[model samples]
Target: MSNIEYQFSEDFAREMDKKDPLAGFRNEFLFPQINGNPAIYFCGNSLGLQPKNTKAYIDKELQNWSELAVDGHFEGEDAWMYIRQKSKPALAEIVGAHTHEVVAMNNLTSNLHFLLVSFFQPKGKRNKIICEAGAFPSDQYALESQVKFHGLNPDEVIVELAPRQGEHTLRTEDIINKIEEVGEELALVMMGGIQYYSGQLFDMKSITEAAHKIDAYCGFDLAHAMGNAPLSLHDWNVDFATWCSYKYLNSGPGNISGIFVHERFADNADLPRFAGWWGHDEGQRFLMEKGFIPMHGADGWQVANSNVLALAAHQASLDLFQKAGIKNLRKKSEILTGYLEFLIEQISGESGVLEIITPRSPSERGCQLSLLIHKGGKAVFDSWYGKGVVGDWRNPNVIRLAPTPMYNSFTDVYQFGRILEQSLAEFA
Candidate 1:
């Protein structure tokens, strides 16, 4: 990954694409058109493009519902009763968890709250929570409410680790040191697997081990990491985790979220949780009994029955992941993103027109590069938008671009480089 071989030419981009083993995957997604041609879409960090098969997947479920109604639960080709099970294996593979430890249910924040009810148990003096500063707004709200739920002040009970002075990303050593600094008071250590804005990928294995050393539970909000980066949640001994499928997973907006709980908690029925009938033991669920006998594994945390249509849409993307493999996707991501980085540097030259806030090392980031534009600001971003470049803007100054491996190409990166050069000349 040192000094990647890149050229700012369409022929070079096309030749590189021809060498790509995963190039065929670009055809599987539908992209938005700009001026009678596909626009350069580098905003996958915010929302992934829809898979072409997604419509067919949802249609099958809709057909079953039309003909069978309630009987669709027991009757269809993909029975609604076992719809979650169908997605389990594929989802488990993406997150590197055992089948029973992964379940698709609820949205990201809701799943976070449900997981906190069990993992965020604050006792006596060990009531503090550790997280990165400037976490996604939903996570910030969830942490604030969870702390307040236990009758503790968030300012005192929550320890937010910030980058020292002028740095844009958190150092791994700093994160681990903060965990030790909090020591006995630290009840839980939670962070985004990859920060949404800076796009730094944290070392989950190291973080989890450090938390365990301090006798605290550890988990991650994998919203930006799940399909974008390779993860071994179970092997990392992560206590609990959750992720939404819309961004990197390419599921529709507000689609189902997945959760992972280690096998140690698989049969610990005494673990307190907010339960619904779907979470109860399947055999006894219909008996309508008074006492709640939770199901074993992550399924025990589910609060409602499966959403067949949404799961169907999710399964379509999972199928592609199964076919393409996370390791392979990550391999290409490094090259694609590195090319974007190289082109950006070449465009800015030594004038310092843009600064990449994300880590320079490929190992420390996914496909995203968050650029701090020095001068043109939002007007420059709007000019790029006019030219059909689709990178997202993060208030004030930063513009984030993600050249996703699944649907984006080397050609997209090349076009982006050319358009950016034009925009900088015009705006700067």
Candidate 2:
């Protein structure tokens, strides 16, 4: 939390918004409507609201495809063949890597699978993988299947870390301790950059260091962390990582994902990978070489051609990020999330129907706060939704409210607090 004291009033929220530097960005997105009014949207952790410029970006590519036909691949300033390069500058900046270290490519899980093939080399006895216990199911499935693909038993080879009993989130000390305890048997330490359910931003830098101490490779699934949290993958000495664009990146649903490979791996063409023609060196790409001849850095991991249309939509979002600057957005994110946390605590105090499971410290969280419903569960979520508050409901009991700093205002958090208060009154 910041040094500023918080108050629970609509007037205060508006005053904060009035003074907020990023408040004008709220008009850049098209929010969902309910009863002809914009719903208070706090679901950016799941799917970000579309930027108003998205359609124009996508339509430009459609026009190129229609006019140029097959020649679109090599024609125009933004050639379809080199579409991936357009996102590299912003992606590199966002992830804290050199331009060559990052590339926009496959979807999240596919990129994970590709990265695992290169990074998760379990030799002899050093075959165990460590990850958070309740990682998103896609990750769980990917890890399980990867172990199985290697002819190893998932139970014996995959180590799932959990929070201490009765605790909502894992302590960083415990994570580092476990990495040390696992020792030489750990082949890889892969975990979410931010634990999805608890909204806990793990100490990724410390985790990476601990993993490297044991000669283990470290990677992160940044689906929930990428644009929402500040990252320094290269500086942290992280080996690899991947993230979906649809969430904080605000690209369309199921859009292209990206990867970060530390610069040390830039020219290591001998590193085993699943290669496609796109990953071949551009100089001899058209010559149809006999050998794979992988491209430099993260581009070598590509297994297919660029998805031009998707890249265009992704470019639109990345452009906004470049313009706003991630550092600026992060500054606002901490305060906005802090404001949400303060308001939730007030409501939780009065109703006692919910408990905030997200860490109270802004340093330990991003744009999201997760509320554990003690009583009404889905009904409580439904009531908030009925009143035009759009938050995300995870199974059994958690409601995730993410006040994205790019477009969400202090007033949105204030309005959500009012809706939550009313809902808790009815449900409690």
lDDT of all the models against the reference? 0.92, 0.91
Model 1 has an lDDT value of 0.92
Which tens-of-lDDT digit does each residue in 1-428 have in candidate 1? 56557889999899989989999999999999887788899988888899999999999888999999999999867889878998888888888999999999999999999999999999999999999999999999999999999999999999999998989999999999999999999999989999998999999999999999999999999999989888899999999999999999999888989999999999999888998999999888889979988888999998899988999999999999889988999999999999999899998777566889999998889999999988878887888888898889997799999999998999999998999888777766
In model 1, the runs with Cα more than 4 Å from the true position are 2-4
Q: In candidate 2, what are the lDDT values of residues 349-424, reduced to their tens digit?
A: 8676899999988889998999998988799888888888889999879999999999999988888888877776
> RMSD for each model, in Å, please?
1.1, 1.0
- What clash count does candidate 2 reach? 0
Give each model a TM-score.
0.98, 0.98
CA deviation > 4 Å runs, candidate 2 = none
- Tell me how far the alpha carbon of residue 212 in candidate 1 is from the true structure, in angstroms, after superposition: 0.5
